[model samples]
Target: MRFTTPLSAITLMVASVKAAENPIIGLVDRITSISQDFDNALEDPNPVRIIETLPHLAYDGANLVATIVSDVTGWKNPLDNDDQLKTCATLKKFATTEEKLLTAILNDVVKVATLPLPIGGLIGLVASALKEAVDGIFGFSVKIAPVCSDAANKDKAALTDLIANIKTAI
Candidate 1:
């Protein structure tokens, strides 16, 4: 493929780059979906069922956060100051529910441990869930830490505090 003009080639390159970058437009919606999922997962009365759902949700949540952080760091249509603040606000709200789910997982582990008769495979299942939860939390924090560390946004103070709260939550 050969462009007849340098300007056309440059235009095409810029267009492709923009298309490849993470779409900031739907960030809040994705965050909202994850947050809602967390809430729904917590409503389950069965501890084991809750444990089963949490790891998958956390994985999805962490991946979204990682994608956003990557876009911000790579200078690929980074969120504006207002959008950054909004994103953090949504995240802060999400963190509370996340903390609840994490806490529930811990409590479930204890409950399973104290059962009179150990159900076959229950221990292994709980262990896998715990491992996945830890991995997801670590991945999320690692990505979010960079966003907080880079002080380019006007909402750095709030963002930093929010990130700290999130880190503590899990």
Candidate 2:
């Protein structure tokens, strides 16, 4: 009886770990997809349009993150049963937190992309500067491959491929 109880407990623990990993994997996949979309947008001929769309994209990203957090954290307010008030409260909270993070990251990307190049010789230097600026703004190291380089030469296509790869990884 004792041996059976211990074995059942170990099985339950393993199942819980697997369940926890699914949400984490989903979050990582969503972030990677959003990153790739942003990168592809950067490569568009009308980058200004892409920049203008950042807020909407950021909001969507934030919503996804908040939903994931709510699921993982099992957050429930007593008012949650009241549909309208619950949604408004949740949105307010999410906007103040996850939305802010998403907006910051998006704004950082825009700032980096808008930096002026001083001279012809400093193109690569500018890209490096942009990378560092993004890192600083996001408080995380953002790996931005040069658009002209072999690794990321086909910018939009490469980003698409990368998104697929990241999704597969997750």
TM per candidate comes to 0.38, 0.33
- Residue-wise lDDT of candidate 2 within 1-170, one digit each (tens)? 01112443454355356435332223333343444344444445564655454444455455545555455345232222343333333223322443333334344444544545222222222223223222222211011111212322222233334333322322
lDDT of 2: 0.35
Give the lDDT of residue 150 in candidate 1: 35
Kindly list the per-residue Cα lDDT of model 1 for residues 13-123, writing each as its tens digit. Answer: 554464333233244334434444544544556667656665665566556566556654655343555655644554454445444544454444444445443332433
- Report clash pairs, candidate 1: none
- On TM-score, the candidate that comes out on top is 1
For model 1, what is the C-alpha lDDT against the true structure?
Answer: 0.43
Off by over 4 Å in 2: 1-21, 75-112, 115-170
What shift in Å separates residue 111 of candidate 1 from its native position after superposition? 14
